[model samples]
Each structure stands twice: as structure tokens, then as C-alpha cells.
Target: MKRRAWIVWLPPVLSGAFLIALWYAGRAATGLQSWILPTPGEIFQAAWNEHATLLRAAGGTAVGALGGFLVAALAGLAIALVLGGARWLRTGLYPWLLVVQMTPVIVVAPIIVLWAGPGLPGIITVTFLISFFPIVVNTTQGLLSAEAPMVDLFRMYGATRWQELQLLRLPSAMPYFLAGLRIAATLAPIGAIFGEYLVGNASGGTGGLGFLVYVYNTQIKIPALFATALTSCLLGFIFVAAVSWLNWALLHHWHDSFERHDR
Candidate 1:
């Protein structure tokens, strides 16, 4: 199984390597001009030269993403709980929730900036807008989708509303919550970057990767810009992998999703 996993990864690794070779060849063919595309070596050199600055940008972006994700998780849980407990509230609010999701973050971000006036608060608002929806939707579905018989049994045994929520509904919702979290982990970085693009500032000189991308592009440091962009992508992927591992660990014991047996 381990070997199979490695084998699966091998193709993508090789493909990336091949693409880099092609890129280098193209740069060579074009004489490594800055007006044209930069060579792999030049890009690597640029990245190395700006490694500290790039690292700082990466750290800032991660902080914003995580901060926003934390807020979203809490807010989503609260919203899901309210929806679960009150059918009328769910009916009234669900459509609006969907509307919020349908609206593009780019369009809403400027409004958020106007409301918040700027800085991390504005960025976090954008991040929250983008990351909160999946959590609420998935968690609400999980909470309300409890087995009818199981709920009846709980009621028969005199389970209070709070007891039912704590023991039955919340437990039932765990898998769905984790699934949403995995999605959020991937999305948070994107939200942060999008927010940064609008806000154009992060905590101090450690502005997020998007700001760095803007600066590098203006300076015509195409290679450095690409490197910073790639770094953000890699950061998002790392969060994805972390969430996947967490999901596997959390669900492997009881959930059929982790079953290794034949269907």
C-alpha cells in the first residue's frame, strides 16, 4: 500500500520535473530575457536572493488564513447550531446563506474594506466570508440528517435538547465538520490572498504573499513573483495534507469512509 501511494505520487513529481526542463529550454531558446520568460536557474536565484522576504510574506499569509479560519469555524458552528435547533430560523436564513455564497468575494471585499476601514480587520472579514459557508452548510446538513429512529430512541429515553445536541447530533456531525474543515483549509489561503489584494496591507512589513506578488510584478521580477505565487500554492497544499491526515485519524475507527475492507 505504501509503495502504491509512492507510485501514485511518482508521476506528478516526474511531470513537474519535465515541465521545469521544458521551461528552462524555452528560456534558453528565448535567450533568458527579462522581457521574455526567465530561466529556471534565474528564477531559483531570484527566490534564493529574496528568501527571507518571501518567508516573511508566507508567514503573514498563513497567520491571516489561520486567524480567519478560526473565526469562521466558531461562527459556522454557532450558525449551524441555531439552524439545527430552530426549523423556522433555518427556513428563513438558509436562502440568504446561499446568496452570500453565490456573491463573489472580490465584489464583496471592497464593501468589507469600506465597512471595516482597512487592515487585518478588513482582510479577516473577507477571509471569514469565503471560509464560513462550507462549514455551516455541511454541519447543518449533518446535524439535521440524524437517523430518525436514533433520535426517537433518544427522545424515548428522555434526552433533553442540550443532551441530544451534545451527545447525538454533535457526534453525528463530526465527519461532516471534518470534511468541511478540509475544504476550508484549502480555501483559507485563497481568501486571505484575495483579501490582501484588496486591502494591500498585512501586519507590518510582513504583508501577505499577494502583496508581494503585486510588488514583484511592478518591479518586473517575474521569477520572484512566480516563486512567491508557488509558495502560496504550496502553503495551501500543506494545509490540505494536514487536514486529510486529521480526517483519517479522526474517522478511521468508526467511519466507513476510512474502511479498508472490500465493498
Candidate 2:
């Protein structure tokens, strides 16, 4: 198992290393100005120098992402449940959810910023908007996709609707719910970053990693900008990996996705 993971990770690690080496070679060969294309050494130095600032920005972004994710997960599940009870409601709301996802964030972000007073609330709203869709869609599918035989057995046992949902449907939904969560976890950062970049909150507060990127870009600090961007990607990967691990631990023994692989 450990070997398999190392094998899976090897390509990405090697690819990243090769890309960095190529970047270094290109930067060194061109002797381009630092602002134009920073060498790996310069980017490393910038990262080291700005570590504290970057850490704080990362923290703020993480907090908003987590808060928004939690709120979305709870509300999304409840909404899905309500919709599950009524086919008409599900059909009605389904299109709207699709519409919301289809709408570009750029068009909606300023309005959110204006209504929410910017900063964390605006970021959270954006994050929620981006994250909620997956949860609703996945959980609803899971809840409704309970195996027919099992559902029939529950009905034979004279199971109440709520009882059947609690004992049978929800358990069946766990894997799907986690899958959506894993997707949502990474998306939260994207939503938060988009919010920050679009609104440019007037609080004069340092916005977050996205803001950090904008600042570095504006200041012509190529290396620092790349470093911050890399950090944001790392944060996103971490979120996805964490959720994947949690899903494995929770469902590996019972869920087919993990169990079949284990076999």
C-alpha cells in the first residue's frame, strides 16, 4: 500500500522538479530582469523573507474557507433532504442550482461584496456559492440512490420514512457525501481568491493569499508572486488530500471504491 502511494506520487513530484529545473534554466539563460522571470533561488529567498506575512494570509484564507465549507455542508444537506422529500421541489430547485453554478462568479461577486460589506463575509458567501452545489447534488443522488432491495426490506420491516432515511439512506450516502466534500474543499480556496481579487475590499486589511498575489504582482516581485501562488496550490492540495484520507478511513472497509482497490 505504501509502495503504491509512493508510486502514485512519484510522477507528480518528478514533474514538478523538472518544471522547476526548466524554469531555473530558462531564467538563468535569458538573464531576464527579476521582475520578468524570477529564478528558483529568488523565489526561494522571497518565500523565506515573506514567510510570516504569507502564513497570516494563508491562515485568514483557511479560516474563511473552513467556515464557509461548514456552513455550506450543513445547509446543503438540509436543503437536499427537504428536496428529497418532494420530487417537485427537487426538480424546481435543481435547475436553479445549475443556473447558480453556470453563472460566472465575476458577475455575482461585486454584488455580494456590496451586500455583505466585503472581507470575510463576502469571501465566505462566494465560497459557499461555489462549494454548496456539489454537496447538494451528490448528497441528493446518494440519498435517492439507496439500493432498491434494501429500501424494500426497510419498507417490509414497516420502517417509518424518517427511520429508513436515518438508518439506510444516509449510510448509503456517506461515500457520495465525502466525494462531494473532497471536491468542495479545494473549490473553497478558488472561491475565496476570486472574491478577494474581484472586490478589493476597502477595509485596508490585508485580504489573503490572493491579495498577496496581487500585491506581489503589482510590485513586480515575480518570485514572491510565484511562491504565494504555489502556496495557494499547496493549500488546495492539502485540503483535498485531507478529505480523501478522511473518506478512506471512514469508508474504506465498506465502500466499493476503496474496497475493490484494496482487493
Candidate 3:
């Protein structure tokens, strides 16, 4: 168990250490001004100094991301199910979904902000738009990917459409849905932060990490900007980790995709 744990953790630990070392070495060698490229230590110090404010901002961003993720997950699943069940619907709507996916979030975000107004709603909308595509596509594929033999068996057994969907399609799609969720976990924060950049509290008193990033950048507080950006990355890491944990908990026992095999 201990060996396995070490094997799992060692790569990330080493990578982090190596990156930090290189960062330190590059800054030491360059003798750059803090404003141009703040050293990692300076960024860390800035984060530490403004820990309270940063934490609050992180919390706000997290809330928006989490809310958007939940909404996206539910809506994506429903859309996938509908599209997967109906050939006509799939043909009609799937192309439009593709168009939406291709449309840049930068283009849509401002429109959302204009229509929804500045704050959490616009942020959540952006987050949902940015993160929901993978879920829909993956889930639709999964739902349709059920083995023909198995589907024939179910039909032969007199299974109703709803029964087949509930018992076979949903179970088959679990891994794909979770995989999409993992991708969305990283994306949700990006959407939230981007939205905040556009529509966050203009007063800057209470907003998300996105707002902090904007404020720090405009003020030319390089270390603080780096710190805020780091915080956003950390949030994405945490979200991905949580999704991975959930995936393991839910799928490890039954799903071949998640099953561990000792070499």
C-alpha cells in the first residue's frame, strides 16, 4: 500500500520540485525586476500576505464554478439523453451544439454579461457554456456505444425503451460522463474567472479571484497577479482532484476503465 501510494504521488511531487527549482534558477540568473517577472518566492510571499483576501476571492470563484458545473452536468445529461434517444433531435440539434462549441467564449461572455448583468449569474452562464460540451458529447457517445448484442438481448427480453435507458444506457455511460466531468473540472474555473474579468464586481470589494487578477494586473502588482493566477490554477487542481476521487469511488469496483492492475 505504501509503495503504491508513493508510486502514485512521486511524479507530481518531483515535477513540482523541478518546476520550482527552475523558476528560482531563472529568476536568480536573470536578475529581472519584480515588476517584469516576480520570483516564485515573491509571489508566494504576496499570496501569504494577502491570504485572507485571496481566500475569500477563491471561495467566490469556487462557488461560481461549482454551481456552473452542477448545472452543466444536469443539463448536459438531459440533452444527451434526449438527443441519444431521438434520431431527428440529434440531427437537428447536434449541429447547433457544435456551432455553440465552436463559438468563442470571449464572444459569448460579453453578450451574456450584457443580458444577465454583472455578477454571479453571468459568470455561471459562461462557466456552463464553456464546460458543458464535453459532457454532452461524451455522454451521447457513451449512451450510443452500448454493445449491439447487449442491446439486442435487452430488446429480446422485452425491455422497454425507458428500462433499457435506465438500466443499460445510463450504466454504460457512467465512465464517459465522469471523464467529461474531469475535463469540465479544469474548465469551470477558467469560465468563472473569465466571466469575472468581464463582469465581476466593479467596485472590487467582493468578487472572485478573476477580479483580483484584473485589479493586480491593472495596478502592476506583478507578484500579486502571479499569486492570484496561481490560486486559480490551484482551484482547478483541487476541482480535478475531487472529480478523480469521485470517479474512483464510483467506478473503480465495476468499471474496467478505472480498475487498477498491478504490474
Candidate 4:
């Protein structure tokens, strides 16, 4: 158990240490100005000094990302269900879905802001666009991946379409949906930040971490900028970790997806 724990924890610890060392070394070697590249200490101090503002900005970003993730998950699941249930619809719509996914969000953000009037709605729309495709594709694949024999058994048992879906298909899709959700959670923040970058504080306010990042950048506050970025990274890590825990909790019992190979 200790070895297992070490294997899981060591790499990240080492990597973080290495990064800190490198940052310190580079600062000492190059004698870079604080604005060019502040030391980790400077960044930490900035973070401590601006804790309240940073926390509020981080909270806004987190909320936007979470809200967008929920919206994407629901919409993706609904679309997947429609496509999975109707072969003709799947055949016709699948290609278009790919096109939607392929389209860059940068190109789409302005259009969304135009329609949504540049605020939380626009940010949420950008987040939704950025994170929507994976869930749709994964859930559709999962729903369709039901074992043939199981499906046949259901049919033979005179199971209704809804019954087949509820009993077999949806459960089979859970792992895939969860996997997509993990990916979506990570991407959601990026989408929210990008939206803020493009739209500014469109809600007639200072907005989220993205806006803070912009403000710090333009004002040449490198330590604060790094601190803001680190905060964003921490947020992403938390969101991903939360989803991973949920995945393990939900799937570890029956699903082979979470089965312990060592066991």
C-alpha cells in the first residue's frame, strides 16, 4: 500500500520541486526583472496580498466553468440519446456534429457574444461550445456499445425501447459519459477564460480569472499574473480530481473500467 501510494504521489511532487528549482535557477542566472519573470516567492507574496480579489475572480471562473459543464453534459446526453435511438437521425446528424466540434471557438466566440450580448451567457456559451463534443461522441458510442447478446435478450424478452435503454444502454454508457465529463471539466475553465479574454467584463463587471489575467498582463504585474495562472491550474486540478473520485466511486464496484489490475 505504501509503494502504491508512493507511485501515485512521487512524480507530481518531484515535478513540482523540479519546476521550483528551475525557476529559482533561471532567476539567479539571468537576473531577470520581476516584470520579466518573478520568482516563486514573489508570486506567492502577490497571491497572499491579493487573496480576496483573487478568490472572488477564481470563484467566478469556477462557477462559470461548472455551470457550462452541467449545460454541456445535459445537452450532449440529450443529443446522444436522440442519435442513438434513431438510426436515420444518427446517420444524418453525426457528420454535422463533427463539423460543429471542428469549428474553432475563437471564431465562434464573437458571434455568440453578438447574440448573447457579452456577459455570463456568452462565457457560458463559449464554455458549452468548447466542451460539448466529447460528451456527445462518447455517450453515443457508449449507448451503442451495448452487447449484442444482451440486446437480443432484451428484444426476446419483449422489452420496450425505453426499457432496453434504461436497463442496458444507459448503464453501459455511464463509464464513457463519465470519461467525457472528466475531459469536459478540464476544458470548461479554458473556455470560460477564453470567453472572458474576448468579451472582457461583459456582465458590466470585472468578471472572472480570465479578466484578472488580462488586467495583470496589461499592467505588467508578472508575479500577480503567474499567481493568477497558478490559481487557475489549481482550480483545474481540483475539478479533474473531483471527477476522478466520482468516477472511481461510481464505477469501482461493477465496471471493469475501474477494476484494480493489481488485484
lDDT winner: 3
Q: How many backbone clashes does candidate 4 have?
A: 0
lDDT of 4 by residue, 1-263 (tens): 65578888899999999999999999999998988889999999999998898999988888878878889999999999998988999999999998988998788777887897686888888889899999998999999999999999999999999999999999999999998999998999888887777774756544689999888888988899999998989989988998999999999899976667666
> Which scores higher on TM-score, 2 or 4?
4
Q: Give Cα-based local distance difference scores for all models.
A: 0.84, 0.83, 0.89, 0.88
TM-score for candidate 1, please give it. 0.89
Superposed model 2: Cα runs more than 4 Å off: 1-9, 28-31, 260-263
lDDT of 1 at 133: 91
TM-scores of all candidate predictions against the true structure: 0.89, 0.91, 0.93, 0.94
Candidate 2 per-residue lDDT, tens place, 1-263, comes to 76578888889999989998998888878889887887888878988999998888888788777878888889888887887777999888888889988998888876887898678888888888889888988988888889899989999999999899899989988887888898899898887776666664546644588788778877877888988987788779878888889998999787767655544
- lDDT tens readout by residue for model 3, 22-79: 9889988999888998888899999999899899999999999998999899999999
In candidate 3 the C-alpha lDDT for residue 140 amounts to: 93
RMSD of each: 2.6, 2.2, 1.9, 1.7
Q: Tell me how candidate 4 scores on lDDT.
A: 0.88
Candidate 1 lDDT, 69-116, residue by residue in tens: 899889998999988888899999999999998998777766786787
Residue 67: error of model 1 in Å?
0.5
Residue-level error in angstroms, candidate 2, position 192: 1.4
